[model samples]
Target: MQLTDRQNNIIAIVKNNEPISSQNIAKELGLSRTAIRSDLSLLTMLELLDAKPKVGYYLKKGKKLTNIDDLLEKPVSEFMSSPVSVEENQSIYDTTIKLFMEDVGTVFVTDTEEELTGIISRKDLLKMSIGHGNLKKTPVSLAMTRMPNIISVKKNEKFIDVLEKIVDNEIDSLPVIDNKKIVGRVSKTILLQTIMNIAKKF
Candidate 1:
């Protein structure tokens, strides 16, 4: 089920054992009945557990993962990393070196005002250096995937929704923008790893 952390813990306590009273659960969790009442009610409503008069609670047959949200609607901010960046005026030679040094596949490009203007991938740099032959003479801007064409996400965007954008755009990563500037980034690597962990539990 798409449960919050506290709700999941409540389920675990009930699952690992059985026929536990709400009073016992609250005491075990160091919470008051008043604190966990809503979670208990919701779990009972979902039929994940059964309650009987004076008997408290017992585990119902699990229909788990059938209701579990794969992504749990987590915000992209939780997975964001600092984006490796380059100036719009920097040479492709410098940009290429920074790309390797930062160990990121893409470099977000910004102007003198620190406003995002473009983005460059290793493929973009490789194509320019190999095809044009003069890396030092060409600004990164000359080969960059320019702004207004960049598909970006916000800090609060859900991970699953952003995953769709990444696959649809065929991109390895996207810059996280806020207030018209880059804040952080999220990538396919982290997305895949996170979901793989969830799948394992399922």
Candidate 2:
């Protein structure tokens, strides 16, 4: 569920004084009772709030990243891309052409077992081949940032925290991992699209 600024503000207010009645909160915040009720229901479904018909709603306590089971259960899965990979032995020319044809900015480099070994981005290739060698001869592995060097996320990660990581790390995308296998990617485009879908009504 996407939260609007108003709903977020209500969350903050509820956090400060949880177990708050919908009527009391509506009066205090100067928002319509119907609007508060609707937002409250959505927030409850998102697990951000807990509500009891007569008892009202209370904010769920904890840091955003601390308890993510709820967030992971939502449209978060929809924002991920199937993990795409290329072999380490692949040539830069072939990789570059494929990347362009696929219109992707980066591709993960994996071993024969499909474990993530590294990541080779369009920028990585461009910078590595700028001055010296033949593009067709240069191997993608030589230009890839090794696995431990690239940032990655787990399948159950929260969308908000993942977005914060992307912005703070100044990176384009993060590979998603499951059982030591590269399962998917979470990119800026996906994040934006998810946000748009969630916020369209607001």
User: Which candidate achieves the best TM-score against the true structure?
Assistant: 1
For every model shown, what is its TM-score relative to the native structure?
A: 0.68, 0.63
Off by over 4 Å in 2: 1-76
What are the Cα lDDT values of the candidates? 0.86, 0.78
Tens digit of per-residue lDDT, candidate 1, span 1-202? 4778888888888877678899988988999999999999998888777888798788777554443264648888887889889899999999999988988999999998888999999888888877846898789999999979999999999987788999998999899999989999888887888877776774
**Which tens-of-lDDT digit does each residue in 1-202 have in candidate 2?**
3468878888888877777888878887897899777788777777788877788778776523234344435544556886667888888988888788777788889888888999988789789768588888888999999967888888777787688789998878788888888888888888877666544532
Q: Pick the candidate with the highest lDDT.
A: 1
Q: List the residue pairs that clash in candidate 2.
A: none
Q: Tell me the TM-score of model 1.
A: 0.68
